[model samples]
Target: MELHVVSHPLVDHKLTVLRDKNTPSATFRELVTEIVMLEAYEATRDILVEDKPIETPVAPMVGKQLAAPRPIIVPILRAGLGMLDGMAKMIPTAEVGFLGMKRDEETLNIITYANRLPDNLSGRHVFLVDPMLATGGTMIDAIHYLAERGAREITCIDILAAPEGLKRLEQEVDPSINFKVVVAAVDDHLNEKAYIVPGLGDAGDRLYGVVD
Candidate 1:
């Protein structure tokens, strides 16, 4: 499990705005997009590319192109939907998929009611986008589900993560899985309700207002 924290000055600036309770939903949504776009730069650093022959005006030359089996971006629904545009902008050719996963508030377990991804992800790289990694249940279940469908490589992108959640994922996840986590920041710990402390509150609510 490779972990990367994007440490750019601009990432820090936008994250500060996001953490402020007064920042409106409209601003919060846009900032999340921009900040994730910056995170995408580091998240896709080693994307595979192949050299292809090309003609540049007068001479024949070889240029690199993203390899076949283009990566797929899967956003865990609703809140994750808010993150789609930014990641799409970063990898325009990447296919988009949807995974609707919600956490049971009482049990802190994940429920998946919808999935629109390819049946076989044998050689495809998957990027799972969700704004927060709190208790890690949502992500852990999501990863296991994708891997069950043959997704050999998976990367999870989050705006903020709680150390408790990250540690839980590290300790309990399937050891054979090839996975990585990328985030703007990892907060101190999880609160009683499983929310990240000092983290942006209810990312979905902050972005799209409350949903029943």
Candidate 2:
């Protein structure tokens, strides 16, 4: 798995606030979107583009546009949905998919509650958006699911990551797959409860208030 941790002043600024425990839901949600846009810019650095010939008001010029087998954006439910608008704004034409998965608190196993994706992702470039990559069970499941569907390449966008989850991708998962992770920050170790230390708390709860 390829790993890229974005380094930008703006990203640093927003993440600092995001890490604050007192940050409100409304602000946290807004910062997630803002920070994602910056990270997405780096995540798509190698995105395929083709030359386009066009005439400007002054003269003719060649431009670039995203090539076909248009990219797909798969947001991993609830919290991930917070990042959809920001990513879609970057690639407006990119198709959207949804994966609703939850992890068991006790066993840390993943459960797939919903899925809305193309049957044949053969040759498709998929972008899976999730805010935090802690234990990585959910991400591992998502990667296998997309890989089985023939997704040629997958780029996971996360706001934060932990060493444990990143290692899981390296040791437990197939290393040859065309997969990469772009995150705003990779924080300290995970606590006993499996939460990323110094993380922005539960992303889903932070983005959308705590639930029963």
Candidate 3:
């Protein structure tokens, strides 16, 4: 698995605000969109494109276009939903899918409660979006789920990640699979309770309110 941490002034500035506990949900949602859009720019650097001949006002020329077999954007439920709009803005033509997963706080295991995706993803390029990568269980399982359905390549986009989680991903996931992770920042570590230290608290709660 390859990891790319976006480094830009705008990304840094927005992230600081995002980390503030005082930021309101409305602002949090907006910043999430903006940051994701910026991250998407870097994340899609190697996106498949093909040359097509088109006539401009002056002359005919070849320009690049996204290749066929449209890429699919799959957002892990709840917190992941906050990133959908930004990714969609970046790749409007791409298809959208959903995977509902959560980490069992007690067992620290991933539970896949829902899935709505293509039955045969034989050659699809999938972009999995989620706000955080805390322990990596949810992501590891999500990747396996996509791989099982025949996805050829998968890119995970997150706002923040912990070293523990990233390491877990490296040690646990299949090396043969084409996988990559793009995030705004990699925080210090996961605390005893499994929360990322000095990291933005529960992204879902920040974006939407706390749920009972």
TM-score of 3: 0.98
Top candidate, metric lDDT: 3
Q: In model 2, where do residues sit more than 4 Å from their true spots?
A: none
Alpha-carbon deviation at 97 in model 2, angstroms: 0.3
Task: Give per-model TM-scores.
Answer: 0.97, 0.97, 0.98
Candidate 1 residues 167-191, lDDT tens each? 8789877989888999999999988
What is the number of residue pairs that collide in model 1? 0
- lDDT against the true structure, per candidate, is 0.92, 0.92, 0.95
The prediction achieving the highest TM-score against the true structure is 3
Of candidate 3, the 10-residue stretch with the lowest lDDT total is 103-112
Clashing residue pairs in candidate 2 are none
Between 1 and 3, whose TM-score is larger? 3
Per-residue C-alpha lDDT of model 3 across residues 79-192, encoded as one tens digit per residue? 999999999999999999999999888998888999999999988889999999999999999999999899988999999999999999999999888999999999999998
Q: How displaced is residue 62 in candidate 2, in Å?
A: 1.9
lDDT of 2 by residue, 1-66 (tens): 789999999999999998999989899888888998999889999888889999999999999999
